[model samples]
Target: TQGPHPVWEHGLNGRGQVVHVGDTGLDYDHCFFRDDSQPVVFYPQKNEKHRKVLSYQEMVEDDGTRDHTDPYSAHGTHVAGSVAGNSIGGNGVYNGMALEAKIFFTDLADHSQSLYLPPDFDYYFRPALEMGAGVSSNSWGSNDVTTYYVDTDRETDVFSYFNQEMLIVVASGNSGRRMGILSPGSSKNALATGSSGNNMMTRNDLSSFSGYGPSWDGRIKPEIVAPGQGIVSAQSDGRVNSNNCGTTSKSGTSMAAPLVAGACALIRQYFMDGWYPTGVPTPSHGFKPSAALVKGMAIHSGHPMQGRLGNRGGMLKGELPEDAQGWGLMRVDHVLRFADSPFNLHVENNVTLKHRERWHKCFHVDSGTLKVTLNWVDAVAAFGVRRTVVNDLHLTVDSGSAQWRGNRHTNDFETNNIIETVQVEGASGTYRVEVYAKHVPVVFPAGQPLALVLTGKGLREAACPQTCGHCVHGQCVHGQCVCNAAYHHVDCSLCDDDKLCHGHGKCHDEHLYKCTCDPHFVMDDCSQCEAGWYGPNCDSDCKCGDGHCDTVTGIC
Candidate 1:
């Protein structure tokens, strides 16, 4: 039977990834397999021929037989279901970190050997990342008599470089010693996990058997701890008497890593959805809780993990230990909140206004440049970045500064949007040039999008002296200002002579009336008389007057 409820379901059920379980072996036909297959999104090897795409359909034993011709190892099956088995019986106390995540499993556990290395461990992990799988869980460990600090023949860095995107979580061995930390788990990059129990009331100090760290390289081990002791999850064979095994109980740092792995998956899903229990942009990716923000938010927001554990170190007294518990217990809710909220800087100038009009919402940017000249009324001090010149419209705004001297630029403006000389930075790309209201300092593409809305009202309020009067901020631009030209009111308050029409022709304005040029004369404003007509209004019957004007013939 399964154990009590899992502590991490309060946040997110792993929703957006495929988790790879590198362990002894798993039975894919089990109920948990229903929700366990996630498509590969990243691939490490492209041109290489030896690389193979992994899947449950292709899982096999060393003998190449699909069935369990060998012994049935429930170790991997239990781990697999916890990391991603479908929540069939509701028997699952906690959903796998990547519940929707596909599982890429392999049996690397060799019982007879003291120190074993599966040939395809690196092969599977490397391609899994290239295919976009973000997390990998290793439940097995080895105890070599060799002294600490001894580097393995296969350098950890070699595979790590290719698997940078994958967060590999390994168990800190169950050897129950002062420092029994194992290989691969000893790697600097691996997030080594220790075990804790679900019964939080009685201070369940560190499990005596969970391996200790301060690896040969001197980095802390058991980076974090979770509910590993007496943990229960789906079994591979069948439920009870049937061949389709059901739930099983087990313990070790192995159980702890999957708890965090599932938490990581929840964190990814929360931020991407753009919501918060309190309606704030969910906070994410910050100074990992060495226990400040988590406690602070927990106390303020009914978060379940308040003053739960009593750690030994005085520094970790009201807090969780740094070396053993890492950042206290796994709090997925708080972790997801941190990942969703962030102060980010974004810049883009290449987007065409024509295409932007199609979007119901204005592009969200915390900071950066826009390729086209933006026209808006009173821009906000926090969101506005910079404004620029386009065509012949000399728009004006003083909210932010810019250094758009054709891409190769330096010198940032603290208060005003800098107007550097424009250049052809992008030959065939959409861009925006806007004047922001605040002079925020940040690098380009600074992670997340700021929670601000760019709308027509905001743009109109930050009106440009030159471009606004042409049409609405996002509307089409008509030709030159006919009324402004004829009336001599450069600002275009009225038509020429206050007569409504241009001296030589009709004025085009909000009204839409048309007037023909007077006899013998033709010019944009209808101001110039023909070559033969000389008198001021051309009414004195000069040589080129109306009736005497040459039409078809050259002479009058």
Candidate 2:
């Protein structure tokens, strides 16, 4: 689903996007960094793909120097190729995600002392953001610790909280499920990933080396799983030609993260191009989504795995936010393919909530199940503080007859994690979704911004909007005003441009709509996979990346 095949058909291949890579090294001269149409692996001295590697910095240097000719190791090159590689050299057999996204590299192999101590998270990421990179990928971490909330933990949260648009994807280290977690991977805001087998359909498919959560603070880390075992990608040999560059297979959570990074690039581009409401972008329809919104969409669309293990190591039939798999394997196709959902979906992209103020929204759903997900970039706690969750919040789903709190993992209410989800099944009724400031010791003056996603079958809007004394923003559907403002709520059932496009634009219809193929996908024929690479011609099922869908649900 994330291979940019059919996604390329929808006019999204990570054009006009840049993601930062924190790694040991990067081979900037690789031939796989170009488009799929290039048959020959030989690149010119000044190739257009040279621009693909935006900027490179050395994070390990103590005195701050650049070795322009320092050939990178195989890991960084593989990670980069997995993120934005094309199959030009591999006969379209090994394509990467987001084939057009630019890369910003930060080399962390200088053997600096700070690498052993607490990291200055802000120091590592801010420079990349200045280079116009909002998304980041980190596939390296310390494996010595079981579970610990170090300074890097709070720093990661601090950087994300302050830079709300940035989405950082971290590897959960190869510390195994029994081990606690790595430092910054356990950070509250970063999207920590675990290792999943090629097809994560059963418990047997989960990786034995993948790290599980129940973090030091007792919150679930490794929020999602992806394929990382026996994955093949471009290998580095300090050459930009196909004859010199080779392919290698590696297994670790490190391999799983770049896939998520590339998938996020496509997902990010989906919203950036204004393809959400319709196939085009108008004034009201398209705008940048917060990092929390992207993270929530990934979680809400995830297909919950079966045979999850309990705390005592016994098997549990079905579990929400399982320790081993978090919210199950990522099913990004379910989110991008808006028409196939079996439930109604609503989104509040950028909701800024103040301290001590409660945000409430009421909706109606069927008797089957209701899933509400809340994700935010929380304000960071002080360093050396055992309690890393500084500004705590809780989500409660109320039906007047019964109530369900969000992610009651270990605490009475969730107090350690920045992401919370409450899924409940009950008789049909009007349900209220509340985001309460359970405790906010440290508060941002502008208020903490969060994203909310609700999905359920037979879903529609109930009452309770205090704007214009009624609903004037969105059109009424199914005998109720379902489509509210995007910041307020977005209904999935509404297909009209007027109702759906009003998300970012609020009721302004003056802007014209046009779809130009300037910087969208790579070329005219978007399929990068060759005729017999993985399937016949590219119409058939060919996976350039390593994720396999669930057998029952068909989600990846």
Provide TM-scores for the models. 0.48, 0.73
* Candidate 2 lDDT, 24-75, residue by residue in tens: 5665555665433332111112223454766667443446554322243457
- Candidate 1: tens digits of C-alpha lDDT, residues 424-481: 2222222233322221212222211111111111121222223223221133223222
Q: How much lDDT does each candidate structure score?
A: 0.42, 0.66
Give the number of the best model, judged by TM-score.
2
Where's the lowest-lDDT run of ten residues in candidate 2?
514-523
What is the alpha-carbon lDDT for the whole of candidate 1? Answer: 0.42
